[model samples]
Target: MLDLNSSDDSSKRNSLKDPISLNVGGEIYTTTLDTLTRCRDSMLGAMFTGQIPTLRDNCGNIFIDRDGKVFRYILNYLRSGFLDLPDCFSELTLLRREADFFQIRPLLEEIRRYETSVPLGLRGGPLGAILIVKVDSKVRVLHFNLRHGPENYELRTCSVRAFTVDLFCTWRAFLALLCERFSYKTTQGLTSPNPCHPRQNRLKLEWVPRPDELPQEQYDKQNYRGLTVSSPEATWSDDIVNMQCSPCEITDMQGFVEELLKISLAEGFKVDLVTPDPTEILTCTSLRLVKS
Candidate 1:
């Protein structure tokens, strides 16, 4: 529990006269007690109760028991109401943990509400072969023509338009792009080849059964399977947008998609699968997402 002493001493609750220096992990930070106690329920507020023993460094600066570098972010949040993280910020999860430790409810809520402005468009990039989707009721379907070629097994190569970079912190990224592109709830979902129409396939994106739900004995003969983007010899790629990701990448991507579905479905909007399973095998004429 937080050690907040609710005594009648108003002077003690007031901000310290001089600038207070905090030595956190060998890094010295300067701030005021007023700023720290703005959120009275926070751990920092409790620490300044005067009842707690203040530990000082060799240089006589008060010491905090946390990472100094990350503490900068927390201090900034205390000074300013908003959390200004850098573009393409990679340490959101770690920062979230720190926010939790500080017991800053507003900061934690800010992280939860944070959305990436980056857009994920299906423009000229390699796509998964199989996709499973759940959709809202709209019979208008967009058609994609997958032609086999020698290089990269390209699917609908001629129609590519780069929209924006892909660095999504959450599934809200996809939701924003989907809402922006399609006004009437018209967006494409999962992709696969239509074996019924070889040489002239009708590439229709539709929902399919989950892996466990599929019949074990007859699953091998089925034409459509879930897409899983993974290979044993896969290497790390810095280019997240163009790079090919395997099933291992699904932890982040899949979690985002699942969250997207939950939010969309709850809001009375249709949801669809824009990608595939991480462990699915790539095949010709597999389903892919595209703008209509």
Candidate 2:
């Protein structure tokens, strides 16, 4: 909606500038805002939309950092244009994500740099060696276990792989936890008569942060973190088995999908929220629909 011939046209360097008031964690910051917010918002939104919340890593403590907090950092940045982040805060993925979404380019770069530069301790379970995924590649996948533990990252060379995807996608942990708990396997690449076939698999993962809720306390002795999975045996009805597998992972594929995946897929394509009509736009790769 811009008039190319307006005063804030290509001729003016600062004409498109606008002052923005931001409430970052509690403090206030007024800065010259850029149009990149729109682009950043859309990009970040697409990357995280429809994610399973519990599956997200809880580095909640990082928001406050070890010594400096978000509000402190924001205030410092606003007053003197300095980013005084603690070692902890700088390593957080979510903060980096937020920074990118807000078009804080320097902050984004700092976060990425901090991840490789900061030295971390030998904590975090799945215990040792965790992948610092830059992008998805064979090195990241085959060497996953070695990459998992938090590291004392003094200074590391980050190849372009850091930008692509990770060694393994986040979904791997979800799959592992699911299979370990459910005693089930995946149906990754089977073709259907309809190549654009849809698959919707939902399972409830029940966990207790403390020990007592678990039936067995042995895992507690090692501080297995009181983690245990309830049986998926009863969660799926006879129908779900049909879709996930020829017999559903728990039931049969067609029948299982028709009941759950198909219904959910159909619901996603429903364009008319007030009415029952919706444009059934199938995801080109898969016959998937997401109404919202």
Candidate 3:
């Protein structure tokens, strides 16, 4: 609740004073009333509206209990309505924290946009250059960035007019390997609407061809499965389809990725697989990949 008299009293005080001084964590900042109240839903706005009492330090400046160093950026945002980081400023995470504390929606959005920027090299595989595969579930979809020697590959559920039979065969062989080595079981049951099994459960496990420019929301929805193998020098040339190994070679997907990372690192390639979940990271020395 705001007292009308308090508002009038504060207005009178401001009329007789210079630019308001804010002592935020022992740091002094000066700004005008209009700028501070521009975002009416913010805490500063509430303070100006008399809903919250303003506290002052001993030096006769309103005191805010927060980081003095990053306060400049917050004040700058309020003044100019722009988020321009200093040239040497690498403290985005810190600034974002402050923005969140201040409940600034635009500033938080800017931080999110900055954080999701992808690396130049790792942008979705060269368009149409490699087959793209996606596995969908009730909650999300997983994309595979599969490779074979210098050639890249993606999983395919059915033949397409543009792609050749060899690509299909390679993908089929990869499935065969997964079945034999990992003991992967496809979903099996008759469709509720008919007598035919209709590949109902198998549909979830099979890799479906992915189109270029996958939906942004889809990528955000699920974790990605990636492999980082040693570069030109290593002998891990065999693709997932032809990688000769006994059942002991890997226990599961995580184990398989771990073994691949271990082999690649021993050969001196710093391959990294980026995934949304840390628990999904493989056991090998491969570094956890992040997009931002």
Candidate 4:
């Protein structure tokens, strides 16, 4: 009698060399049996080598219950022996879970390496900027041009000033950037309540002006004197008016915003969205950035 075991082994070897079709969660994939069995100790290897039982769909394709969209990455990793993902891909945790289920140690390790290589701010989640500009009480000065008769031709001049009082950011990398480049100091630690990422740590930064900087009152006086000297036709009453003004601590909130956008773009971040639209004002209440 012919050796049935020897004949069966020969047939199995021939099947392993042929192309295999797989239906993973209703998604169809075709590859060679050699690729599936490349990692001898993996779940896929055991299934293809007949060590683990597998079921086939009615269409005669091997069926696997898994996420079909994510399986593309798994198949590509097995084929190329390397993991390559897009720069904007954010589903790393899901991919890691799938790799664990398949018992692919190498893939899991590669994902770990990728996570470590990413920037600290991006590793946590999307980067966001929250800035609030506060304007102090304004001082108005009125000049009466008596030369124009009882019409009281009054010239009204008002100076408005604003400063950044509260600056909050969701990413530490951005906070570090501000501290390194713009001389911002950490004022306090804040915990922001986010629906998606609850209890996330937010940072509040402050920039205090140096004592050498001119006070707001002196600056205003110099500006008014310059205006008086420049206009020879303008007449002023003997009433010497002095308006009360607060000391200047912060002056250029807009400048800070400009530098922030510039550096963020240079560091491979794209603007996700801004509140109140950019056309309305240079300073925004909220801004979000994402890594490319």
Q: What is the overall TM-score of model 2 with all chains considered together?
A: 0.24
Identify the runs in model 4 with alpha carbons over 4 angstroms from their true place: 1-17, 120-292
What's the TM for model 4? 0.40
| CA shift of 151, model 2, Å | 62
What is the overall TM-score of model 1 with all chains considered together?
0.38
The prediction achieving the highest lDDT against the true structure is 4
**lDDT-best of 1 and 4:** 4
Candidate 3's displacement at residue 40, Å, is 1.1
lDDT of 2 by residue, 1-292 (tens): 1112232233332332455343334334444433223223333222223111111113211011122234444334434545566533322434443554444544555544554564433111121222211111121111112223487323322211111111221222322333333322212322121111113222222111222322233223323221222222222354222112222332222222233333232212222221122232221111222222
lDDT of 3 by residue, 185-291 (tens): 11331111111122321111322122345443343333322111222221223321111333232223344455434432322234334434446555322233222
Candidate 3 TM-score, C-alpha based: 0.40
How many collisions per candidate? 11, 34, 0, 0
lDDT, residue 203, candidate 3: 13
TM for every model, in the order presented, reads: 0.38, 0.24, 0.40, 0.40
Alpha-carbon error at 141 in model 2, in Å? 30
lDDT of 1 by residue, 103-134 (tens): 88778666655633322222111222122333
- C-alpha positional error of residue 169 in candidate 3 after TM-score superposition, expressed in Å: 46
Assess each prediction's global lDDT (C-alpha) against the native: 0.44, 0.29, 0.44, 0.54
Consecutive 10-residue window with the lowest summed lDDT within model 2: 135-144
